[model samples]
Target: MFKRLLLTLAFSSSIIWFGSCAQKSQTTADQIEKAKEQHAAVVEQTQQQQKLLEEKTRKLQEENQQLQAQLQRLQEEKRELEKQKAQIAKIQKFQNVKAENLQSAQCEINPDLGVPLNPPQAKPGECFAIGYLPAKYKYEKVKVLVDAGGEKVITTPPKYKVVPKKILVREESKKIVVIPPVYKTVTEKVLVRPATTKKVVVRPAKYKWVTEKVLVEPAKKVWKRGRSFLTHAVATRFDPNTGDILCLVEVPPKYKYIKKKVMVEPPVVKEVPVPPVYKTITKKVLVKPAQTKEVVIPAVYKTVYVKELVEPAKVQKIKIPPKYDYVTKRVKVRDEQFLWVKVLCKDNMTKDAIIKLQKALKSKGYYRGPIDGIYGPLTQEAVVNFQKDNDIPITPGAVTLKTLQLLGIK
Candidate 1:
C-alpha cells in the first residue's frame, strides 16, 4: 500500500507540474502572437509612409519642371526688353509718356504647379512687347513757315495715328538761255469749197410783126393824080425821117396789119438739195463764259532721296533705256546785240557803242528775253528795219558806231 501511495503521489506531482508548464507555454504563445501582430502593423505603417513620400517627390518634380519653363520664358522676355529700350528713348522725345504707360508687373509662366508667384500680364514691369509697341523706330521733321506780313494766328496741333503719310512735295525753277523774236514765213496748204452764185439775163423771144398789101379791091382815096383806073401807089415812111417811099413796087403802110404769131419757151426750174435747218428758242438759263479761270497749282517734288540699308546688301543693276529729248514749244525768250551800228543807221559814228539793240530797245518796241551778252538774227533784223524805214543808211545787217547816236545808246 505504501508503495502504491508513493507512486500515486509522484504521478499527481507530475500532473501539477505539467499543468503549470502547459499554462506558461500558452502565455508565451500569446505573447509571441501579440509581438507578431505588432511587427506586421509596423511594416504596414512603413509602406504607407513610403507611398506618401513618393507622391510628394513626384509633385515636387512637376513643380520644378514648371519653374524651369518659367525661368526660360523670363530670360526671353528680358532679352526683348533690352532690345526695345534704346528705341523707346527716341520715341519718348516725340510723344508724351503717361505714368501708367510704364506700369510693370511680373508674369507667372505656370498656374497649374502652384499659386502664381507672378501673374502673366500685358503691361509687365519686366518688359514691353515689341509686337504691341514697335522696337524699331523712325523719325521725320516738318517745316511750318509763317508769312512775314499777315494776321497773327494761333496754331493747334493735331494727333496722328501710325498709318503712314505721303511725303510733301516742292518745286524748283532755273533760268535758261533762249532765242528771241524775228519775223518768219511758212507755207501751208489751203482747201477751198465752191460757193453758189445766181445771175439773170433777158433775151429776145421768137415773134413776128406783119404788114399786108391791099389788092385792086382796095377802097378809093383822093390822090394827086385823081382816081386812077389802076391801083394807087402805097407809101411807107421811115420812122426817123418823114420822107415817104413809093411802095406800089412794094405795098406800103396803107395795108392793114394782120395777125402775128410768136414762139415761147418754157421757164427753166431746177430742184436743189437744201441742208438741214436748225432754229433756237430762248429759255432762261445760267450762262457761262467761254473761258474759265485757271488755278495755277505750283509744281510739287521731293527733296530727300534717302536710300534704305538692306540686309545682305545687293547692288541692283538697273538698266536705264535710252531716252530722247523733245521740244515742247518754240518761244522768243531772249534777244541781244554785240555789234557796232552803222553811222547812217542812227546818227554820228563811233568805235564801240551799243546802238538800238533788241535786248535794250524796249522803248522803240524792240528787244525780247534776257540779254545774254550776244548778237543774233533777231537783234540784227530789228536794227536793219529801223534804219531802212526811217530813211537812214540801209545797211544789210551791220551795226556801226554812227548808228549809236540816233539810238541814244553809248
Candidate 2:
C-alpha cells in the first residue's frame, strides 16, 4: 500500500511539474516573439526610439536568463526529489527483508508454564512494540523422593552353654631314662713352646726426586684502558676521555717446575713355618658311662563342648516413603513483539519534540547534527539508522514510540 502511494504521488508530481514547465516555456516564447515584433516596430521609428528598444531588448534578455536559471533550479530539485525516493525505496526493501526473517523467528518459551510467552494484543489507544521481558521466578518448597522402599535382612546368633568333660590325652607307659656320664679331674705335664720363624725384609725401598711443572695462573685476554703516562691518568673503558683508546691484550701465564720425592723400588720379605707349641694343664677324666631308669606315667584329659545352630537368618520388608522438594524456576510471562505504535511526524511533531528527539539521539551516539528543533535531512538520517540498529519498525524520517521509549523519553 505504501509503495503504491509513493508511486501515485510521484506520478502526480511529475505530471504537475511537466505541465508547469511547458506553460512557462510557452509564455517565455510568446514574450520573445512579442519583443521581436516590437523591435521591428521600433526600428521603423526615430533613432532615439531605437535606443529605448535596445535597452528594453537587453532587459528582456536578462529576464530570459533569470527564467533559465529558475528552470535549472527546478530541474535540480526534481533530481533531488528522485534521489529521496530511491533512498525511501531502499529502506523499504530492507525492512521487507527483515520482516521476512522475523516471520520465521520462534516465540520465547515460559519455563515454568512450558508454553510460549505471548503478550496481550495492543488496544486501540495503546502502542505495542518489541521489548526485553525478563524472566520471573519464585521460590517454593516441594517434597521429592530421596530413597525407595526395600527389604532388609536380620540374623540372630545361636545360644551356647559350657560344661566340663574329661578326655584322655596320653596313655600310661613304663620308660627308661639315661643318666649323663661322670668325670674326674687330673693334672698332666705338656710341652709349652716351639720355635717360629719371623718375616724378614730382604731389601729396603729406594726413592728418587723428579721435577714437574704446575700451573700458577691461567692465560687469558683482558681489556685495559689506555693511560696517559705523563699525567698518570687512566681513562675509563666506558665514557672515556678524548683520544683515549681501550685494548684487549693476551697475557701468558707463568709456571715453574718443582722437584718431588717418589719411591723407585718396593721392599722384599721372606716367611718361615715352625712347630706347634704345647702347655701343662689340669683336666677332668671320665669315671662312668650313661645309665637308665624306669618309672610309671599317667594319662592326660581335657574338657570341650559342641556347637549347634539355634536360629536361622530372616528378611524384613520396609516401606520407605518418597521425599520431595521445591526449587525456584524462572518463567517468562511476556515476550517482546512488534505492533502499531504512534510516532512523531508532521501531524504531531513540534519544535520542542524535535529538539528532544535530536538530543536523545545525540546522547545515544546516533546523531551529530545541531539540536535546532528541526527534523532536517541529518536528523531524519539519524532516526532511520537508529531504528535499523535497534530492530524497531523502520519509519524513515519519523520517530516511533518504541524509539522514544528505548531512548528513555516518556
Candidate 3:
C-alpha cells in the first residue's frame, strides 16, 4: 500500500510539472505574437504618413503651375496697356495741328480782256473824243481826261469745284476665347491628421500672382492717301479684324477661323470727273445745276425792224439731212430736138467747160471778165456778151457746142 501511494504521487507530480512547462511556453509565444503585431502597426503608420507627404507635395506643384500661368497672363496685359497708352499720346499730338495748315496752294483771278473795235476817224483840230483802249495800264498819277480812255476792271464769276470729306471709322468685335488655353487648378482635400501631437502649422504660399502692364506700342500704320472727287466712290464695307485688347494671357490666343481682308475697287461710270485735291476749299459753292433756270429777260419788242439780215427762228432740229445724188435742170431749147446732137460727157463738166470756153475766147481776144473757171453769173454774162458782140446772138443761157466753136473752143 506504501509503494502504491508513492507511485500515485510520482504520477501526480509529473503531471503538474508538465502542465506548468506547457503554460510557460504558451505565455512566451503569446508575448512574441503581441510584439510582432505592434511592429506591423508601426510600419503601416509610417508608410501612410509618407504617402500623405507625397500627395501634399503633388498638390503644391499643381498650385505652383497655376500661379505661374496667372502671372504670365498679367504680364501680357501690362504690355498691351502700355502700348495702347503710347498710341493715344501720338494721336493727341496730331490733334494739335489745324486743318488749314495742312493745305497747300491757291487759285487766282485772270483779268477780263477788252478787245478794241474800229472807231470813226477824228477830224483835225476837233475835240478828239475819249477812245477805249485794249488793255488798261495802272496810272501812277491822275492826269486830265486823256485822248484815250482805258478798259475798266470788272469782277467775273469764279469757277468752283467740289471737295469730298474722308473719314476713318473703327469697328470692334468682342473677343471670344475660341480656343481658350487650358491650365492646371489647385483644390485641397483633407486626407489625414496628426495623431501623436497636434501642432499649429503655417506655410508661406508660393508663386503669388501680381498683374503688371507693359506697353506694347501699335505699329504706326500711316494712311498714305485719301480720295476727294466730285463723282465720288464712297464705299463702307468691312471684313476687318481690329487690334487686340489689353488682356493678360498665359498662352497666346489661337485662331479658330479668320475672315480675310477684302479689297473692293469701286465701279467707274461716265460722269464729269473732278480732281482728287484742290488748292483752297470755298464754302460759297455756286453749283451749276443739271437743269437750268430760265430768267425772264424783259420781252423787249420795241422797234425791231425786219432788216435784210433776218435772225432765223430756231426750228426743231431736223435729225436727218437730205441725201443728194444729182439734179436735172429744165432747159427751154425751142429749136428741134436735134436727134444728131445727142451727147454724153465722160465726166459731167460745168465749171471746166466754162473755163475752156473762156480760155478759147481770150485767145481770140473777144472775152475780158475773168478766167476764174466758175459757172457763176459773171461768167454767164460774159459768155452772153461775147455771143452778142460776135453777132452769133442767142438768148442768155449756159454755153453749148456751136457757141463753144464760135469761142474758138473744140
Best by lDDT: 2
- Count clashing pairs, candidate 2: 12
TM-scores, one per candidate: 0.23, 0.24, 0.23
Model 2 TM-score relative to the real fold: 0.24
Give lDDT: candidate 3, residue 315.
29
**CA lDDT of every candidate:** 0.40, 0.57, 0.40
Per-residue lDDT over 69-117 for candidate 1, one digit per residue giving the tens place of the 0 to 100 score: 5565566557656655754453343123221231221152224423233
Model 2, 157-182: lDDT tens per residue?
Answer: 23333333467757886554333345
C-alpha RMSD between model 3 and the true structure: 55.5
**Candidates ranked by lDDT:** 2, 1, 3
Residue-level lDDT of model 3, residues 1-410, one tens digit each, is 99667555655664576468557644654454456556557657866786787688658855765665556556655765675576445434433433222111012111221211211353433221111111111213212221122232222222222222333333433432122222334443322222333233343223333344433443232221233221232332222364322222123233333344333433333344332321221122233322212323222221211213223323232232222222122222232110111111313345777678778766766567688776555555565556445544332333444466666666
Query: What is the lDDT, from 0 to 100, of the residue 37 in candidate 1?
Result: 53
